[model samples]
Target: AFKLNYSFEGISRTKPEQNLSGSSKKLTKDVLLQKTHEERRKRQEQRLKLQSAELLQSHIRSYIVRKHKKDQERQLFDEIETTAGIQVILSKLLFFYYPKEDRERLLRIAERLLNIQADVIQQINADKSFAWLIKRFLLLCLKNTKDNQDSMVLMKCLYVFTVDAHTFSYLVSKDYYGHLKRLLESSNNYLQETIVLIQKPFKFIHESDYLSNLVLSEFCTNFLIPSLTHNVKHILVPYIRNQRKEFPFEKLIRYLNTGFHFGKSHSLLYCTLELEPDDYEPNSDSIQVLSKLSANLYELKPTCDLTVEDSDDEEEEDPVSTEKRLLLSEYLKILNRSDKVRKWINFFLKHNHDESVLMAFTNLCHNLLLVYKDSMRKYLLLYKFGLSSTYLKRLWAYLNKNNTGQFETKISSFIAWREYHTTLSVFCDMFTFYTETLTDSETSDTSHTFTQNDLLSMSKLLKNVARGLIEVAFPMCRSSSIPSTPEVQHLYRACLNCVRMLYTLDLRKKFCPSGFWTSDKMHIPPDLARKDYLSKKISSFYGARNEEDEHLPPLSTIEQRSLAILEELPFLVNFNTRFLLLRDLCRNSLGEDDYQRLHHDLMHENVVAIRRTHIYEDAFDKISQKS
Candidate 1:
């Protein structure tokens, strides 16, 4: 059991086991202190490394951000100095009304600012309050300057912004289009560019709304109607296809379907808003030639003025060379090659032959009709071959023949009829001109007048033109009733006038004393006829020029044929009303005051109708004045 050993100083003596335990406790405490100190030192070193890394990273990040900022600033400064530069320093100084002593410098800077119109606009937008000031300065500079380069630049910039989808509304709100229109009037050459700009915004806005309606109205009346020469299908068709809402295409079609009236209305209706292109009639010599013809037609050569040499020259040269003339078929084939026109035609065919498409084609044909007579030959040939429907008919038959009423076939038929009508009018004009020229031979020397061959050639041309017109007009007449519509009535009236003119010319040729030499009843004296045997032979040849009998029956015989033609034509409901008006005018001509007053009233009414039909006449005048 246990006994304890003790030392004499009242201190207890430790046993061997206790001594060992005390040493062990001291060693354990020392080891624990060492471990804790090591742990604390390692933790301190780790925290210092982490702090240093974080500081270095932050510095690098700050340097990168600053470098990027400096680079951006430098790039912007470079841009500011380039051709499309900002010139912000000059702008700000001008805005603050800096000294008058540096007026020259300021003016130079202002000019630069004006030169870069788009840049100036950007600068203006950057500081909204400065817009008015900048704009005023620009206006003042424009007013004081005569050079148009700056003005054109300004217009170009505005147009550029107007076509941008993001900026269109802002530009419109700022009346950029209005300003462009004003500038356009001042400068006549930018019409095409203006139209392009005007059409660009349409693609983005095709819905029903007030803005869209306004845009449409402006496009139709101001841009479309006024620009007669350009084909708008390219500019408008794509947008129309995309649009969900119905546009005013029907209204436009109805208006264009009507015939053009004469006088100022004709001039206005034919006004082309397109700028003269570089390739357009570059030869100035054509004008001189045309003027010479006009002068010669009005000039009266004295009798016995014809020298033998002059007669020889006239005989050698036909005076009218038909070289370089494109036939209608050739012209149409060339037109068909145009990618845009082909696409439009294909689009129409795919769309089930819409009337608007037909109208567009007719309008194109109408413009072709208005071309100079040399070009008129192209249309004539086109009617003969290109639109003969043989090629198109076969093409349709090969394709879905069930879709017989495709665009090509329909447009060809319409164009054929239109060309025939136009050609008939041309024939009537030529016939009248020849008749008058021949009749004038009695007053002038006969030797200098038109030869029998010339007269025969003219007659033959007229007969051919008449044959085509009748072929087209008769079938159309048979299909429709007489005078079914005003358009049809107008065609009937034109045909009637043509017939009357031809008949009058025929009678004059048969009975006129001037044409006695060519008359069938004239029994030439054998002696004189032998002495002038060459002249007699020429006269007899012309007299025997009855080759047109098969195609064109005699005009007197044409009476029954015309009656048959009229029977098929649409009946004119307003014919009796017009007859009564005419009767009243006839009575008024006999010094009847009441009838004259009534005639005047009717004339005024007719003028009102003309004004209504020609809506652009008044606007055209205003446009002309502005230009």
Candidate 2:
């Protein structure tokens, strides 16, 4: 504790002077005078040393006091529960609950204990010992709902590992999907965080590993589509759109539970429709990323013909019977927010003429026309000749004539193609909803009469959406030997519904309120156009040569299925939405405006509306309040 600048030699030399009193010093003065004169320099040095020693004593006391206080505080903290020796703590917390933040403190104090080198994180994912810890943490996160006390800490550890691409890709490449699936049981608060963390690596992953992608894709399909969370649809759509099928999907129907609300799933389809070029590029191993991307898209947004009519049990049961539905719906929301929908729609027009694919085209057009019919003339500009020509009756007839009807039957059976039929049903319902809502809203406020512009806008929007949908679905009606049970029914109803809402046959009355098209009969063209598009898509699916090159086709069965599935995306997406939209409309007790309000209410009730993906929150009621 001492702070003396003087050495021990200086202290010893000056010690002799300390015992002397003033009188004793005076007696020695005569004797010391002669000695002092002889050694004046040495006496001066010793005097200075004495003064410095006195100063050192004060500093020594201050140092001792500070050290004592620190030691006492340390002792008290040690006695407290958390700091109960590292050995006991490590043994207790190593499993079930690792305080990642506290572990960080250990590193801060001494880096060598864990022996974690800077390169350790990257290697840990591949290293057997460290990899086990990562897996253990992953499993722990999935043990309970997102709000579990230990869940957040586990997520933090995962986050640290993800900081490096090497570690992250390695972890993801392994079966992290098992843990991801477990998150479905977690509360909404934790679900959001868990999904966000998991989705990070997926943004860059090509899904080269079949087992890995299949497990992950299935997990996502189940969790994303039925989830009530709006964000989920947006998240999963990119994986589904503009691609063929590479992922296993024999259980797709089972996976997409009846609880799925398709109207809200549009964002997913849109996202699937848009393709990312980087995803299409080959990986370092020269594996084609496009095939995987395409396959996932097909599974996500199928245009092929297929349907799963609700069995007695499914029809009788409530969709909200379990938590799985909510999770799937949430995933769908994430997919929808992306551009996957349009990508699949465009792909169908180019590849197949299946009715389901046709329906998807109609559905996509319906969405666009409803939202942007003001630019119909401009839409016509974007509409390619290839798409239009495929729909043209003469062109459709020419294509079908070449087919012997065998391909037609089998092609028609494809689920993606069949989904187009469902799409028409969905739009019919949406149009119905829109009309009812507009009518009620217009009339509800009785004091305010329906304005001329409001009526025209409503009429125009409805008619345009119907016409756009018909342009894609009507051709199938013309081509059908036996008209579709619901596809044609919905298609006809949709067109008729528009007329009913508009209170006019001249469809231009909706767009041009002046009735200019009435005299010219311009509305016929849109109706005829719908019939042409439907016929062409149907003929294409049945008749088009699926082989881009018979000699060098898809490298594997997966690639072929993916390509085939993608060919049917437009229809699958459209039909699925239609089925959901119809079911919802039929089930809804409310009228149009009330129905809209109810839809709004349901979405607003979702807890993840504002929070991060994996942020687990209070139960349903508390989440609803926050939303």
Candidate 3:
């Protein structure tokens, strides 16, 4: 019984130990679970904080962008307000000062106001008082202004105001139409200014209201067209001739065509040209009319002179003089047409009296020759009418007489010099045409061919022209001489170009004879020839002589004269042309040493940088190699 009791005690003690170990393990597992929950809560808080920070940054960025845009808009509004305020103040001051004859202040104000015309025009439309002040001031200035300067200022102000549609409408409503019309009529003395004023309103035509269109039509019929008709020669002709930027011919035609009354009859008045009739052909009747007009223009004296009473009776009989005017206008129009000009020129060339008439004809032909160029070539060729030589002879004779002081007025000298220049230019054109025709004949089947007689005549004419030009015009081409007047300078340059062209043509050997370069009347001095021979021998010894020197003849007058002209008047020919001339002379008249010396001098003397490679040089080299 005692043994059984001890075993039960041992079993009970072991059971208690096992229960304590289980309790310890359960306590450790509970602590691990608490630690894991704490870690998960910390991670959630971190993630929420990161999202909040990004949201805050994006909101702040958007707020900044909105603020920047608002600030820029506000700044722009303030600038615009300030500009508008400045324009108003300037306009007010301009109005206040203009009536007091403050010309200087007015000009300063007008110029400043003109620069901001956009704002000023806007103000003129929005503010009735401002518009009234500007309109009244402009009218007063236009009405009372006697000074050209004041008129120009007023014109600028009016031009600016008229270009804006609203301001133009406002001005028209306030009796400005009559004042503007009167302003145009009164300002006829200032043709260009009147034109400027007249053209501005036309710019608004497409976008203009009906009243504005009516006003523009009135301005055109009552003022613009009439003034243009009366002064077409004085104003429109010069404008067209000069190619002025102020008013172009095409724009004027378009403006005139906008008028309801503008027809083919009025077309002649504006452009001094007529619509080419669809059925109109170049017939003998038209030629006869042109020939009659030419006879009248070239007549030294009128066929009959009418007394005052007779003239009145004739005027009463003719009433409008429409036929005479139409005939004269047609004559003037034909002078500009290349196709008709040939016939006109032929008629003019047939008659030869009166220096003034000849001068006019020469000028006309020169312009035609210049403008028509190769188109008029066949009519003026050497073998054809020989008109170029005829014109040149007449001009030279007139010039010779003028040189003797027979006609020494400033106007006479002016016309004579111009005639001479034009004659030379005409000759150059003809010669170029001739050479081109010759080249074309060789390459293609051309109808016109030059004969030996034509060549001989051309060469003789060239020699005479060259000699005369060198003696008369080239003396002024010297660099050391005092600078000549523009007229003289123009004449000199024309002469130089003509001579150079002639020399170039002469080199072909078809136009000029072999002996043309040599003159029997001119002989070189012994000393100069000997010096030249010795220098050439030395050059040959020093390996400076080229194979081209073996068969070269002695220098002649023509060669000497050409060389002297080129050497003495270097300023006349540009470097490239001079270089080519020298090269040609080297191959023909000059020795190799002379060419090298001149070439070296040319290279050194020129101020502009010379390109080492040239198209001309390449072409010349190719031609030389091919030959």
Candidate 4:
């Protein structure tokens, strides 16, 4: 059924008219109500749709606000990062040009870039460009004014950070040393402060070959030596003490040799040399380095000339010269620690290149004799015969310079050469007697006892050798001019003792009844004793004998005369006299059974005596001189 609805001012519509009964009327009304309900429900749905639209609009606005805020925040962050980067670049540039003004800011930047406490070294290795920048800034700080605390603080930071061996090379380069020298030279106080700063941290630079070489170059002869001489207590002592940290001695040696071709040697203080045995291996780089260092040290002459003003002058002396700041004696005070003096001498002599250098070194050693006599004597003996008798010649020349001292008598007499030649003649005679005795032994090979001719020959050789040795004694005791000096006296005594040992060896048979001498008496000429000058000198020289020595067994006339002669030449006394005496007795004895003992004795005595007197002699001198 179609239902018709009526509005107040509008027309109502009916789809169709069917029946006008009760059922029709009720159905029409129900349709009208359903239509009304449908309209109201549609309105409610529209209202809900409007509310949903409003909620969505609000959400969109909120999203836009939040996104805008985030964008603004991002923009601000970008600006801050850009400003920081610009600040760093500007600070670096300003510090590079005007370090004293912007030092603090640049230093902070450098610290951040180069000094991350835990990973700083790693960072330095990873960022090459940043490291370069840091390096440039560091140098700027170093080049700043002496009074700038910022520079000092930057240096402290640098020292702390660059101590790492892995990164040290990155912080400094070969060119930096020159900058350091220029910076430090302006003020002595600044120089000392710089040294102090570098000194403590130097211990940590254990590796980095490039840095090692640079450090050595920076502290080369010209720069460090002058500093060292002027400030030994403050500079040199600390540097040497730091050698315990594996300092680059090898590089130091190379630096010393760089200018050696022009006769310009490295100014190496003896204190600076930390030479080890490991530095002296054959055909090694270290050996070459060591040789070079030795040459440099030997040839090094002080650049600053020190003049001695006449005592009569009343003017004040000038400030001490760099060369004269530290004397050779002061150097010796340090070198004496490891017997370095001996090592230095041997090294120079072994690699002999310049005679003038050798002469200078020899002269310096001669001067040491007064203070270090015992050690000097041993050193002299080491070169006495070796190096073509160079040491002997030097010694002789030194002795000839002075006419005073204990050796005045001998030098005045000029009889040492004569006595030496005479002794040589006697030694030849003794050798002839030995050969003759040996010949007789061959003939009487079956006999355990000596023949009459063999014994007579030995006895004659012994007497002649003893007399000749006594003559040699006179000159040796009289030759050294510096008698009051213990060193001169000691050397004189050593030589004289060597002679006495040989003499005693020749006269052993008489002293101990070897039975080689036919009688206890030797036909020593009374005329030999007539020259009482040597005798009285002998007595005065040795001084009064101890009372205990007087109680010994009475000596034969020949023995007494030899003893009297030995007393005048106190320098001739040696502890090895008995060994020498016994060995000679065995060598000349006719008994074949004693040959082995004689050879053994001679070998032992030769080793000990040679060390004292003739070990360093040339082979020809050792063989020909006989003593």
Candidate 5:
């Protein structure tokens, strides 16, 4: 039924109904109330629909924007990775473009991109076209054509490049060394520092390749050694020790070299080098360089042997122990070979050009002569035919000739051409652990091998040096060319005593009925084995007792060479004369901290020596002086 009802609105609602105005009005109201609820529901639905439509529109817009942004980044990465390489990307960054915000962003991205293909690196190096591109990029990266200024591009490139070895190998293969060398001469400290870090991998690259070998040889000969002759201090001591961490490894390598140490330690004092390189030019500014490194050169004190008091007697000190002897022996073990001896002599001769350096050599010589107290003379006799006392005397005179700027030698220097040529001709053979130590059964088959012949030759050489030093020091029988005081005579005699005592052990075989010569190897002369030197004097020593004093056997030049080689034998396996410089250096320069550490190591080295050869008695006092 339809009903109509009165409302606030002028119209009443009716739906197919007939009713009276008064009574029907009540009935209509009930009908209208039921319909009213349906109307309210329709209105609420409309409002909710409008709200949902607004929300859907907003989300769709946001999602489309995000997709576009990601697509742009992906496309940017693809374009850069495909059309061009990272180097191109880096090229866009010129030194002048110092956009702080953008620079930070690029730096972060480059840092994060650590891994790169080695094949790409190889290809880039193989392609010479890349060279032009690289040159242009670097030149552009520089801020200006003049005035020292930092290059962010240089810093960034190296920082990125040195991530690994292949990266460095690639850069080096491209012949970056030439440019790098040029850069090293620059006044800019940062450039030098950055280059140093980059060069670290070069150490590995130089290990096996022939080209690297050639490079190193040339570098040492032309650049390094020449630089040293003139400016050894510049090469050795950092211009600023206070800020040594600032200098590169390359500079340190110069100072770390052998020649530098020889001069700094002993050249100022009176001693001369036996060796001089083929081309040596001392820098005119050497004095200036020395001043820069060591302001108080005179203040530098000499090393003094440390004395530890014995517990048994308050005044007396314990003598060097067997363990100490062993350690010293082991230290010398490295020096036992012919190659090492040759190298030692070569190095000794070259550095011995200066007085201070010569003194260092003497210290080493003393160590060599003293190590095998009893066997030195036998070894000396083994090769005395080739080695000469005159040569040693000449060496000593050259060393002692130079005073502290007060006096210098007037005599012309002599370079042994034969010795020099012989040295230059053969490559130094690498030593073996067993061959050097006399423990390894497998010996290196090379030009230089430690054998009976070597023992004979080197023994002779060492003896010449020892006897020569004594003669020069005392001139008891020989006329004194050098100053000889009573004290000097005593020292010289003591040194002679050391040699004589050791000879007593081997000589006892003749004086004693029992044959003291243990191995027949020691008895053979070099002239018989290898014909190293023609020695006639040894025949008399080999002759009867009456023949020994009556006609003194003068070692021929060749025989003297043999003796010189032999004298250095005891020092072969246990200690090196070279180490004496290092030792004496410690004596003077090493503070308590270094002294304790080095002293401990030395003690350990000595202990090792004693284990190999025990009771190495000072035979000169007991045997040589007796007669």
Candidate 6:
């Protein structure tokens, strides 16, 4: 019985152990599935967050773009409204206002409004009453001013009328000659405004045949010449009566100069003289008037001997005398075909020994020299070539004789500097003519040929001019005591550019020896070279100097100053010369590492690739109208 009970207990224990193993396996599977579900949920939340952030960024960008577009539209609409308001007010003032005083006052307000917004002028069109307003302004210019204030308002209105292209067109199309002639005849505060009106047609004459004919025939013949002769007689009559008042010299001179300038353009001077009837002969009265005026001008004492220094301080320019000279000079430009003008020229030529007459002749010739090509053949016929050449040489001698001195005063220095600059300008124009002639001869068929003697004469003149320029520039560059005012510097720079122009024309080769421009012999003094070298070496060893040092005037050492001068002289150096100069200048300055790196970059870089991207992007621009 005991053996049977032991067997049953062992069987029960085996069954319980098997059940525990099955339950543990089930728990392990459940835990693995729950961990997988948590990871999937987290991934889904991350994707949603990323999408929301992207949407928010897009919304911000769109809002900014819309705001900018709306602002631009608003600004444009505002400009349109403002323009419309201005146009309406101007129209009312011009059309509805009948009283002169009311019209003038309203015009001033309109002008101020126009000034406040420049776009109002630009937006003005001929289709509007602005055209009528322009005509009204021009008619007002004809009437005498009540006061200086009235004259100024009229002048400002005329200027505003001219500022719009369409308004100017309308202003010029009308015939105000009858009115202008009256204004020219009368002495009033409207001289400036009248001159402004007269100049408008002259300015646009080249663009319109009607305008050109009007100026040459109606304006010059009836208004300008008659008025000029009348005013001169008026002034001279007063002088003869021992009521020696200041002649209206400036006014007369301005009128004559304006006419001369207009005539000088398009060979209209000859036309002006020829504008008279086929049987037109100077009346006895005109000849007598011109004769008396010429005699009075010639009798003025010689003032040419005034030294540059003395002239700057002591000799205030005699307006009467200077204007007299200028008037005589202008008469030289008149065609000799007219009996009165011919008599005037011959009278002055006979009295050429008179200091005033000679000065006038010189001044005219100097002006002619600068524009020689333009007036050369005409003047050659007028003076005969040899006489004209002699006049120019005599003028050159006179300029050189007076071109003296170390001036202590600013005014004197400026005066002396200007004279030198004029001398350089005259030569620059001469060289420019020479270059043009050569270029034309090479590029096209031409009848005129430059002789060897002509070339030699020009070369000699250029060298002499260059030497004079060097004399001026070298001292100014070397002297640290010279005032570096902008005007002085500008004159200096202009002089240097003239020299560079000479070099550009290949005239420098004839004058400046090749050895002169060598890098080693750049006109730097030995001490200056040493100082530059020492400064550079010290700078390299001590790292860069303070930023304040950079702002100091670059004209320190001769080499540094020369570099500064060269940098400013864009006219002097062409591309190849500029590159060579830069290379030579920077050669010893760059470090070996920097140089190598730059070289490597330049050699390895693909310029075409870099340029290609920009080229393709720019190839089909939607806004460009160009084919």
- Candidate that scores best on TM-score: 4
Ranking by TM-score: 4, 2, 6, 3, 1, 5
The sequence of per-residue lDDT tens digits that candidate 2 reaches over residues 38-69 is 69888888999998998899799987986676
Please give the CA lDDT of all the candidate structures: 0.39, 0.40, 0.47, 0.44, 0.36, 0.44
lDDT of 3 by residue, 1-627 (tens): 455444344444434334644554345877989999999999999999999999999999987986676556444544553455654544444434434445554555566667878887787778877776676556544554443545676666776666455555555555554555555445566667654554555455456556555655454455434423444445534443454333333333443334434422332342323322323343333332222223223212112332235543543545244444554344445454655455545654665455655655545444333322133543332223233445545554554454432322232243555555555555554445445554444532111333455445544554454444444432322432323443344344444454554455444434566556344233223333222332342110011234344555554334444444444333333455555544454444567787788779988995876776563242322444235
Query: Which ranges of candidate 6 are over 4 A from the true structure?
Result: 1-424, 437-498, 507-521, 525-554, 557-561, 568-581, 584-594, 598-627
TM-score to native of every candidate shown: 0.27, 0.31, 0.28, 0.37, 0.26, 0.29
lDDT of 4 by residue, 546-601 (tens): 44334344333344445554453322334344345444444444356667776677
Model 2: what TM-score? 0.31
Ranking by lDDT: 3, 6, 4, 2, 1, 5
Clashing pairs counted in every model: 10, 103, 0, 10, 79, 0
Best by lDDT: 3
Compose the digit string of candidate 6's lDDT tens values, residues 261-308. 332121123223323333333332333223222322322323564334
The true-versus-predicted C-alpha distance at residue 606 of model 1, in Å, is 67
TM-score between model 6 and native: 0.29
Q: Candidate 4: give the clashing pairs.
A: 385-617, 386-616, 406-483, 407-480, 493-571, 496-572, 497-572, 504-581, 505-581, 538-568
Worst 10 residues of 3 by lDDT: 535-544
Residue 179, model 6: Cα distance from true site in angstroms: 27
Mind sharing the TM-score for model 3? Answer: 0.28
